[model samples]
Target: MNPIIELRHISKTYYLGKLDVPVLHDVSLSIMPGEFVAIMGHSGSGKSTLLNILGLLDKPSGGEYLLAGKEVSRLSDDELAGLRNKFMGFVFQQFNLLPRMTARENVILPLVYADNKTNAPDELTLLERVGLKERVNHKPNELSGGQQQRVAIARALINNPLLILADEPTGNLDTKSTAEIIGILKELNNAGITIVMVTHEPDLTEAADRTITVKDGVIVSDVSSGKQRTLAAAGSDGSMAAGFLTHNLLKLQRVRDYFQQAMRSLISNKTRSFLSILGVLIGVTSLIAMMALGQGAQEEVKKNISSLGSNLLFIHPAAGHQGGVALEAGAVTQISLQDVDAIRERVPGVARVTPYASGRGQVVYNGKNWNTRIDGTSADFPVIRDARVTEGRFFTDAEATSRAKVAVIGKTVQRELFGDRDPVGEFIKIKRIDFQVIGVLPAKGSSGWRDEDDKIIIPVNTAMYRLLGKENVDTVDVQVTDYNAMDDVSDRINKLFAVM
Candidate 1:
């Protein structure tokens, strides 16, 4: 009989960091067609390594391997994969079924990688052979341990390969399931399919036609059942025989095999893949939401500031000023109404001017007390501050001259004092003075920690004489008619103040 598979002087070594360890040493073996062989070995006896070498799952560090009389050791990676796929199939100790796919889908997996003109048979035939005909659509988790292994075995035979490489196929089964699997293997061997199984079970070892024991990187014994079958050798048919595919087709086949394996892995470990995608989803969502909010805020700011219609500028007297004059230490008075009049008359393009004093204090009304911001201003306060009255009305020119005690409360004051009730006729106290809430200003949320709406507006003359006793306004707000002439207006205001 001729050998169907051969390993000559095969030695495989691996590196653990900088340390080299040898697993198989000068191992040589051969298997004839239609033979049932069992490889027996203790753990770490290089049995798995040898099985890997035979299955072409791992390349040996040194050796020559031949499959069907062709030198596979000299073949490239792609060539090796093609040869393995065409003539060999594998059954793992754990069954290695994809959890997301059904039993019938698992059985068809080998055919997806095999290059053949033949189509896969109906799911019924495969399921019937494995005794899983009634459970063809069941996923791996839905089936028992034994049923899953049977599906795995059906997958191994799907491509009609000449050899089956099973690593501890019955390791995870019960006595009944073990006997069932062993019987299936026997039936396959009887049908001209050669099998190479790795196991320590004496019953499984005895069932094979031959048993080879491995120990410490070498074959310890090789016992035969005294039965052998013939194998055909390659001839000049102008095309390579079985297990011999062209290099390009081999590469394409290997690429397909790799992707298929990757897909299987991802499906089997669903939680791991889901966790990885979750991390990416969170990062992408946060990044997009923040960018959108920032862009919206930027657009709103541009719109509001531009609507003010430029030409507006503010002038502050020197520190500790009252009127418009730059104050000196211990000086009695500084900025006064004269400064407001001066800017209106002398500044180029000057339209109107308003000067004001403001601060925070406690106010009381109707036996309730609350802290409120107070603003004292002229009749031009709304125009200078860019505030609008939503109801009622702003102070009239007569109210400014008479130093009226009437007041307009902001939107926040309305909410705090009246809740949902209308505050138009309500009364609130400001620094021991009773004032009427004439109107409510439109709300402007928070601007640099200051609640712009939580305040009351009163005539500046009243705030100075009736309550605060302040002699001068510290700042002057100027509104000009010609925005394009702002620079000239500011220069003229400076020139007019230079005389004092």
Candidate 2:
């Protein structure tokens, strides 16, 4: 008889860096229609890999594979996928059901992917056929290991495939569940579905019309079992008794197959499987840490900024204009220390004022230097910005009064200059100007496009006359005396800067 499936000189090789390791060496086999065959092998004997190749889950490195008398190895990818979908079903040891989907959805997924031209079977009929009519709506996690495997079997049969390739389909089930699964396979086999299973259990081989034993990547035995006495003796029982007897026998067979495939996968790549998990572990850890920090800092900033007073007003640079009003060249220099002083003196609703000047510059320590931010502000700057001192102290009024060459460094600056040691009282030069580090501010984390904690702050006067020598402040921020007066204070400041 012509075989339903045939393998010719099939060899599968996998690459480990530059070395080629052969798993299946020149393997050739054939299976006739309506046949129940099991391939038995020890761990690393290439049983599962050959099954994968035969099932089209993987392609062989070099060889010919034929299914239903059609050459599969030379077929294009889409053509192979089409053939596999139409005629083959795979039952894996782990069940491989989608955890989030109900049993019915899991079974229906293959049909959805396989056939697009016709309406597929609904949950009720498919579930009833698989004996899962009562548990159709339950998810894989909600069911026992046996039920999940049963669902896998249902999915396999849903396609009405000619061949079933089961790779250890009952590895995690109790004996009772194993029996139920094996019973289902026997019934399908009786219905004329050709099954090619790889199992380790000797009991499973008893149900097979043909058993092929493999060791060290070579077939050791390919033999047909004479009609067993037990199968023949079943005819003496009533029809129901005979049916139940055949069902129970096949259940033990499936359990054996499940363990055989699992042992092979586990022992064959002991290091690879274990090491693969480490990558997932590190990825999960880093992902969780990043999420926690981002969420925690966002909440902290929202709380801190909210407490700083709702009346606080911030100014961001506008390339065009405010309220969609375009400005002339340098028109926005409208914001200055003059505006800061005016807001403090003219607006009764304004509480405090601070001028902020910031741009990028370089910092030098010993012979090693780093590019960093340069910001110039006064003592009231921290008060207006609502910044807290993490260490040492903020610059004093006396330091701002004399235009002192003292500065406060942020977390990153301290790390770059002093490593783990304190940076306070240490002198560092920025833009060729030597200045003592008065304090180290706490890391405030990232905000928008800026790292607020990566800056080095100096007195506004020293920045104006000595380092930056800028004519006008880039932005001016003011705190209103009361939250209700915020709008009025802002209106007053806007008018004061209108002529600039």
Best by TM-score: 1
lDDT of 1 at 238: 16
lDDT of 1 by residue, 1-500 (tens): 55777889999999999999999999999887778899999999999999999888888888898776766776678777777766777888899998888898888876655667265456568679878989999999999888999999888887667789999999999999888888888888888788899998777887788999999999999998776554334222313323256624644665777688778777777999889789889989999998899999998786567434356878776555567676673264367877787777766698878877776778776776778888788888777667778888888778977889878888887777777788787777788777887888877666668777888888888877786787777677888888788888888887787784
Q: In model 1, which regions exceed 4 Å deviation? A: 117-119, 228-244, 247-500
Worst 10-residue lDDT window, candidate 2: 229-238
Cα lDDT of model 2 by residue, 1-500, tens digit? 56777789888889999998888878888877778888998888888887888888889988787665556676667666666666678898999998767898778767544433144446468678768899998988899898889889888877667789999876777888877877788877877788888998877777778999888777778999865422211112223222212222234444555566456556666898688778889999999999999999899989657534456876544455778888763465545566666667877787777777776778888776878888888787666766756777888878876889998988888888788887778888898889998787766777668776789888887787788877777766777778888777777767766654
Whole-structure CA lDDT of model 1: 0.79
Worst 10 residues of 1 by lDDT: 234-243
